[model samples]
Target: MLKHFNAKSLFGMSFLVIFVLLSSGCDIIPGRHMRDQAKFEPLEASSLFGNERASQNLPENTVPRGEWYDIESNEALYTGMQDGEAVENIPIAVDRDVILRGQERFNIYCSPCHGRVGDGQGMIVQRGMKQPNSFHSEQVRSQPDGYYFNVMTNGFGVMYSYASRVNPEDRWAIVAYIRALQFSQNAPLDVLTEEDLEQIESVVE
Candidate 1:
């Protein structure tokens, strides 16, 4: 004995309930479309950017945009070439600190192949790999400082370039350390007198 029931009201309530249930499951609406899209495309290229090409009609010898030459003279534009003239003719001094830093860096980066003594007898060489010439050799000793720097920067023979790995100052420091190694190996025994031996003994103590 219900008081009353309206047929139209009951029908409207059922429709509202169906609408709420369908809207609540919104994630299912795009399920088949997403799966189809993934099936069509399995991979995509990265959108990263790289260096731009030089502009057309530029002179062949002209430096590229955003780049600067170490020497302004056209004669010194090539690799390993430096202008003969220096604004100040002072020779850069090689200090102990710089040599120590160079030695540290060389041990980390070069010891694997060049050895701690620069004798081309590193671990790799012990394993039967090709050994580089000793830095103490006459040919290497006669080479100019710039020559070593250039070789390290651009590489020679089987060696790859280290321009990206080491900076200019560090390269110069390594050159100094190499000189030190050569000097120690070739030092005259006569130069070490009794006083020098006593000094060494005291330092050891």
Candidate 2:
């Protein structure tokens, strides 16, 4: 009887140990480690969904979190467009300081492709890159100020977008500087003041 009781007790202890070991690794129960949980990774294909793609498109009109938004609801301010057309002028006021800021940004960003004078003769072009159109060209000058902003934000032919590197405000500033560069190369003689002419004559002398 004593031997039979001992055997029975040993069997009970072995069963309890096995039960705990099995339950510890099982994730179905609450509070178990889920190190190998099922999930989809980027670009991973899946037949579970009808589209057979792991990624889904974001809903329209919903901006992602941590993104900048225009609080005043001025769509043109951010998009450089109004009523399906590029705006004709800068949305913000332009002053001497604004132009100066634009010059700094232009030299850093635009001068690499478009030369320091907007003449499409930067060092990159000298090294066998395609030459960009001069800002002083009649065709280019005819484009509205916002057109330049749009080009920078969305990129033109052979040019990558600067929208990530440059904010909308700075894009507008660069546009203003481009206009200044164009005027510097093509200013009308009638617009020259007497003092300006004197300086020109002095340089000529």
Q: How do the residues 1-205 of candidate 2 rate in per-residue lDDT, one tens digit apiece?
A: 5767687788998999989878777765765558657888988898977999898777789766754867359878888889889999999988899999999999999898898999999999999889998999999999988899899989988899999888888999998889899999899999999999999999999
Model 1: how far residue 155 lies from native, Å: 0.5
In model 1, the worst 10-residue window by lDDT is: 40-49
What lDDT would each prediction earn against the true structure? Answer: 0.70, 0.88
TM-score of each: 0.55, 0.67
RMSD (Å) per prediction: 11.8, 10.6
Model 2 stretches astray by more than 4 angstroms: 1-67
Q: How high is the lDDT of residue 93 in model 2?
A: 87
